[model samples]
Structures are given as structure tokens and as C-alpha cells.
Target: MNRKATALDVAKRAGVSRSAVSLVLNGRGDGNVAKESQDRIRLAAQELNYSPNAIALSLRNQRSRIIGILSDEVVVSPFDGNIIGGADDVARSRGFVTVVMDTERDTARDASAIETLLDRQVDGLMYVTVGLKPFEVPQGMLRVPSILANCYDEHPEPQLHHVIPDEVKGGREATEHLLQLGHEDIALLAGAAESPAAPLRVQGYREAHVAAGFEAREDRIFMAGWDIDAGFHGAMKLLDDVSPANRPTAIMCANDRLAIGVALAAGRLGLSIPADLSVMGYDDETRIADTMVPALTTMALPLREIGRAAMTTLLDSIEGNTAEAETTVETMVPCRLVVRESTGPAPTR
Candidate 1:
């Protein structure tokens, strides 16, 4: 095997002292190291392809330079992608790397994953679950500064930092958008009860209607699943069972998939989008939203932003003394509605 280049080789090629090469490459040089000398060292290092030993550096720095990640739902949903990407971006800038293990949505698996990350000697760790169900933190992780992003809290006392979308705000904003387009009879096709987001979203729907001084119709509120199939069936029942006057002028499906399902069902009934019925959605998953016939007018849940915030919090906790405090934080990033061809002025009889 070919041998790797070392600092001594770099110094020899640059005609400089090994100390000079080390100081310039490590960015720890004082004024005694001339800019011209530094340039020569860099050029030599590049020419020889002298790579620093990360393991040796880690030992010297007393760090693994690796951030460990645990996710509850990376199989069925891509939400964890945003969190990981956000964290990775920050980690790279700080010369850190990441390691991840999926918990497969099981609590036992979650605990085991944490243990694995711990065994790997990660500088810090993050554990993420999809809902508000009180998840027990990986035992003994109380000593690490951890943060949760884009999901609700399981821990009531919440000893660590948490970042999540403001579901109530997201829900109310979605409803208000429909109302702005002159929709009074708006319906909520919600997610399953397992979704902690469901009840908060329902609350937002109600608050919006109340703000408009229109009593929200209980019949119009449907607790459905988050999938397209659920929306398909729910929209059918809502459309078929209600009186013409009582039928929803607009519908807010829980997520983009559900909204697309609503559109498909409405289309099957020969109902014109925006003219016969308007539909709105949440999560704003672009894969489905951008391709819809009229395109989807949906509420964006700030998934990427959730990832960004969680990363910032994790880095801070990893590098700062703040991690040692008993502080608990809840940050609700803003959400907005994107109006597309799907919504319009209410149809007149």
C-alpha cells in the first residue's frame, strides 16, 4: 500500500520547519508565521495531499467529533430527513460528523439505539419521536444536552430543549386562508387519534371559525387518517352524506397526501376544484403538491425550519455550558399558507 504524506514531508517540500507547517495548517499561527510562508505550506500540503489524522486530532481534542442521532419514524415518513440535514449542515461547518440509528418506532428499539450511540462515544445525542406520546428519554441521557425537533413532547417536565411546529397556529392559519377566499363551510379531515397534532389542529380549525363568528359545524369535522386513502374515503363520505347547502364549500385535509385524495374524490364526483369545491392541505410535501392538476393550496409546516432549529440547539448544547442547566425551551416557528389554483371565491347558487 502507498504511504500517506506526513507533516515532515510537507515541511521538506515547502523548505520550512515542521512547526511552521503545523501552525499554518491548523490555523493557530501567530504573527511570527509570515503569510508567504503560510501560502508555501498550504501549497505543499495540497501538492503532497497531506491529510491530517482525524483520530489523532480527536484524541488531542478530547472529542469524538461525531453527533449521534436517534429517530422514531424514518421508515414511514421523511420528516427525520429535514432534522438530519439541518443538523448535518451545522455539523460540517464545525468539523463534526454524524451517526444515525433508527428506532423503528418502538420504544425498546429507541433505548437500544441510544445505547449504541453512547457506546460509540458520541459527543452528544439527539432522540426524535413522531408524536406527543410521553416518550421516556433514553435512560442516563439526562446528562447530555438533547433537543427534539418538528414533533410534539412526550415529557411533561421536559428537561431538554424541544422544537416543533405550532400546530394550532398552523391549523388556524389554514382555515383563515379558506375563509379569506369567502369559504364559511370549511371542513377538517384530521389525522388519526395517534397524531398528537390532530387535536391541536382541530382546535385551530374551531378557533378560526369562531373568529369568523360562524359556529363550526360538528358534522363537518372528520377525524381521518393522514394517508391519501383515508382522505379519499373521508371526502367521499363527507361529500355524499351532507345536504347541498350544508356541504363544505372548502375542505382542509390534514396533510398534502390527504388533500390530494380529497381532490381525487372530488374529481370522481365531477366536482370542479375552486368552482365546485376548494381544498386545502398541510405539511406541503412538494412531491404531491406541485403535480396536482390545479396544484395544491396548502399550509407549510416548516419542516426544514424545524430541522434547522434543532441543529442549532444541539450544537449549542454540545459546545456551550448552557447544556448543564435544567432549562426547558419550546420554540414554535411560524407557518404560512400558499394559495394556488385550488382556492377561489365561494361558488354562488
Candidate 2:
């Protein structure tokens, strides 16, 4: 077995003392060690494949250089993996590593998950959720530099930072897109009324109509589950009762899944998308949105960006870069509009 190279070996190869190698490698040799000597030490270390002892370095600094991520659910879902990727990418670039623990959305496991991370002596913590909602801060989180991602607290601590999507804007954008296509009579297939995202999106839908100098038909807005079945049922309800002259020309679904449901229902009814009716959706759902029959026009949540921002905020707090006396911080990330083949100009009645 090949023995791991040591600073002593690097120093001998560079013709410098071990102390000199240590100073150079630890970034404390600047202004003390000669530039040529530093260069020689680096070259020797590279040749020997010498690596620093991370544990020893961490102990010396009194920091683990590891960030702990405690999430309500696995961040590896098709709609959420980007959050983990984003956080990991930023942490690596900043010379830190991440440890993730999923609570499986079980409140009973939250305490245990937090304790496990704390035991590891993580430098900071990030409490994340797969969806946007309010969550209670785990006990002891306030004792450490912590941040919230894709979630917030009802009564946030002044220093606590939150990163979340702008649901209202996303909803409005989806509606506005359909309106721009000259669809004056629009229907909304929204999510469950109790969902936080549902009301915000509904507000956006109404705001779009108001901006266009019209009021949305209250009867045309249907609240249901955030699924294809709900969308199908809602779309049928809107189309089945109304005469062709009074029916909506466009439908704005709260999510891509719901929009897919609408599309399926429309197909069964022999309605050609955008020819007989137009459809728009939110939460881009990358895997499903672009692969649909006519594809999908939707608003994309900046999931990865939200993760990056949350990690950045937590690091800033840990480094004392934020205002010391600040009580709370809320960071709203905007969603982007992805135009696809599912939406088009309203057909002339």
C-alpha cells in the first residue's frame, strides 16, 4: 500500500523546513516566506499529492466547515433536486461541505434530525421544505446561524433569513400570458383552497384581469387538488355547462400537473388545444412540461436559485456579514415564464 505523503516529505523535496511548509500551506506565510520558496513548496506538495488533514485543520479553527441541511422531505424529488444541487455547488465553492437530513415531513423526527446535525458540529443550518409554507423553527436552531428555504415562519426572528418563491407573481404571469393572446374569457383551475400557494395564485389571476381592464368571472375559478384529476374535473365543469359562445377560450392551471389534466380532458372532448382553447400552467415541472403533446406554457419556480440564496444568506449570517441587530430577513425569488407550444392566440368566436 502506498503511504500518504506528508508535509515533512514536501518540505524535504522543496529544500524547506516543515514549519515553512506548514506556514505556506496554511496561508500564513504571506509577507513572511519568500515568493520563490512558497512556489517551490506548492510544486513539491503537488508532486507528492500531499493533502492537508481536514479534521486537524477544522479542530484548529474551531469550525467544522460543514453546513447542515434539515429538510421536511427529501430534496431529491423531480421538482426539488435542484435545491440540493444549488446548495451543494455553492458550499463547495466556499470551501465548505454539506450534510443533509430528511425529516420525511414527520414532526416526530424533527428533533432527532436536528440533534444529529448539531452533534456533528455543523457551522450553520438550513431548514428547507419541498413546498412553500410556514414551519416552526426546530428547537436549538436559533442558537446557531440558521436560515429557511422554500418556507418561512409566521413570526420570524429578526436575524432569521427566508428564501421562497414569489407565487403571486408566477400566478399573475401565467394569467397575463393567456390574456396577451387575446383571451378575454379565461378560466382558472386552482389548487386546494387551503394551500398557501392557492390563494396567492388566485390573487394573481384576479390581478391580471383587473390590469387588463376587466374582472375575472368568479364562477369560472374552480378550487381543487393540485393534480391531473382535479384539473380534468374542473375543466369539464367549466366546459360542460356553458354554451360555446359563453365558454372560456383559455384555462390557467395552478400547476403543470393540473394543466396536463385539463389537456387530457380537452382531448377526450375533441377540443384541439389553442385551436378550440388555450391552456397555461405554473410550476414548470421540467420533466413533464416540455414533453407534453403540445408541450406546456408555464411559470418556472427558481428552485435551485432559492437554494443558492438560502445557503448564501446562512453563510453570511455565520460570517457576521449581516446586520447584527436585524430581526428578520425575507428573500423572495422570482419565477421565470417558459413559453411553449401549449398556449396560443384565442381563436375568433
Candidate 3:
């Protein structure tokens, strides 16, 4: 194999001194080096495929240019891998690399994992979770600039910055979509209260009803678990043996799996979707949502966006690009609505 190109090769090709090549390639070329020389140096480096040595650069700049990521099963689980993909994209574009460690949702391993990342001399850190929830901030994270993605600090006075999706808005929008379709008697299969996202979404559901000039029926909201069985049971209790006139025209699930259960229940009851009842789901999961028989109409969690925002925030703090005093401790990304075959207008009474 041919030897790798170096700064010296780029300098000779660009007809500039080694110091000039270093200055231009390192982004300090503006006033010190002529614009023409900077352009030539970049073109020569590109042609020569010459890249800076990360180790040497780190030593000279006193920055590792590495971001450490602490994940609670995000790396191993298929559910939220896009968060890390998005974070890596931003990190790579900013001339930084990322190292990820998965704890598989084991909170007990958090401190050790964080300590390991810190030992690697990372310039910054990010903690990502598979879902939206609050956790006790790892004390090791406090030693460096850190951010949280799809999770937040549970402390009364939060220390680290967090980026999360606007779950309440997502819940409200799902309800509003059903309401706009002329469904007033909407049933909610909200996730269990243990997950922070559930209550916020439930709150949004109520907010939508209130804004639409109606009071939501408290009895209709079921704090179901986040699984197909919970959804099936919840729907059965709502629809089985219930008179058509009394049954809800639309059912909104906290997740797509629950929506699947609702659909299964509807099928068993010999009810045609949309024509007999409308269903909505959340999370817009990878293949599950789009490939469903009737394709789920759902609110999508902004997983990738949350990751990108968290990394950006962490990097800004590391590079002194953000004003610490003015920086907010939380960043909330908005969830998106994907319309599909699963939802429709309420049946005419």
C-alpha cells in the first residue's frame, strides 16, 4: 500500500510552508494566511488525501476531540439507535469522534461506565436513554461538559442540560387530529405512569379536549402498560359487549404496539377499521408502524433530533461557543405527526 500523505506533502504540493499548511488546515487561516494560499492548501490536501493526525492535534490543542456517550440500552436495542446515529453525524461533521458504552438499562452500572469514559479524556459527554424518562444525574458527568438525550436529570435542581421531545404536544396533536375528524368520544390507552412520557401525553390529551370546548371523560383514560396485551385488554373493556352508540368513535394509543392490540381487538369484534372505529398510535416505530396491515397513523418521537441537539449543546459548551449564564438547562424537540391508513373521520352517529 502507498504511504499515507502528511502535512509536509500537502505543504509541498500547495507551494506553501509547513506552518502555513498547518494554520490553514486547522481553521486559523483567516487573517494570518492569504486567502489564495488557504484555498491552494485545502485543494492540495484534498488531492493528496492528507489528513491531520488526531493524536498530535489533540496534544497540541489540549483537547481530545472525542465525545463520550453513555447509553442505557440505546446501542444494543433496536428501538432508539437512530439517536446515536444522529449524534455521530453531528460529531463527525464538527471534527470530533464519539465512543459509546451501553449499560442495557442497568442504572447500577452508570457510574462505572461514566468513569470509564472520563478516563479516556473525552472533551465532552452525552447520556442517551432508550426512552424519555428522568434519572439521577451521574456524578462523574458533572466533572465534564455533559448533556442528556431523551432523558433528563431527576434532581430538584438539575445540574446538566437535557434534550427531550415535546411529548405533551405530540399527545395533544394526536387527540386534536381525532377531534378534527369529528370524534369527541375518544378513548386513550395511555402508558403506565412510571414512564414520564405517559403522563405528559395524557395531560396533552386533556388539554386538547379542554381547548376544543369539552371536558374529557376521566373514566375513558386507561393507564395501560406499554405492550400489545395491555392495549388488547384495554380495548376489550371499552368495546366488547358495549353498545355501538356508547362505544368511542376513536381510540388513541400511547404507542404503536398498543395500537396493534387495539386493531386486533377491533378485528375480533368484526369491526371494520375507520368505518367502525378510528385508531391512532404514537412513536411511529421503524417497520412496525409503516408495515402494519392498515399502516398506523401516529405521532412520531423525534429521536434523532433529540440526539443531534444534545450533542450540539454539549459541543457548544466544550468549545465555549455558548454563554453559560444564558444557556437554558432543557431543550425540547417537537414530535412529528405521520398520517396513515389507521385513522379516519368519526362515523356519523
Pairs with steric clashes in candidate 1: 134-154
Candidate lDDT (C-alpha), each: 0.78, 0.85, 0.91
Pick the winner on lDDT between candidates 2 and 3.
Answer: 3
RMSD of each: 5.9, 5.5, 3.8
lDDT of 1: 0.78
Candidate that scores best on TM-score: 3
Off by over 4 Å in 3: 1-51
Better of 1 and 3 by TM-score: 3
lDDT of 2 by residue, 1-349 (tens): 9999999999999999998988777655666689999999989988998866877967887889899998888554556767877888877655578999887778888888888899999999998888788888777687788888888876744446789999988888888898999999999888888788889999989999999999889988888789898999888887776778988999988889999999998998888997888888888897798999899988898999998998877876665556668665789999999999988999898
Writing each residue's lDDT as its tens digit, candidate 3 over 1-349 gives 9999999999999999999998877645767799999989989988998878878988998999999998999888979888998999888756689999999878999999999999999998899998898879978999999999998999998998899999899999999999999999999999987889999999999999999998999999999999999999999999999999999999999999999999999999998888899999999999999999788999999888888888878877776667647657999899999999988989987
Using lDDT, rank the candidates from best to worst: 3, 2, 1
Candidate 3: the clashing residue pairs are none
Q: State in Å the error of residue 253, model 3.
A: 0.4
Whole-model lDDT, candidate 2? 0.85
Can you tell me which runs of candidate 1 are displaced by over 4 Å? 1-57, 75-80, 131-133, 241-243, 321-326
When 1 and 2 are scored with TM-score, the better candidate is: 2
User: What's the TM-score of each model vs. the native?
Assistant: 0.80, 0.83, 0.88
For candidate 2, list the clashing residue pairs, or say none: 157-327, 158-327, 158-328, 159-327
TM-score of predicted structure 2? 0.83
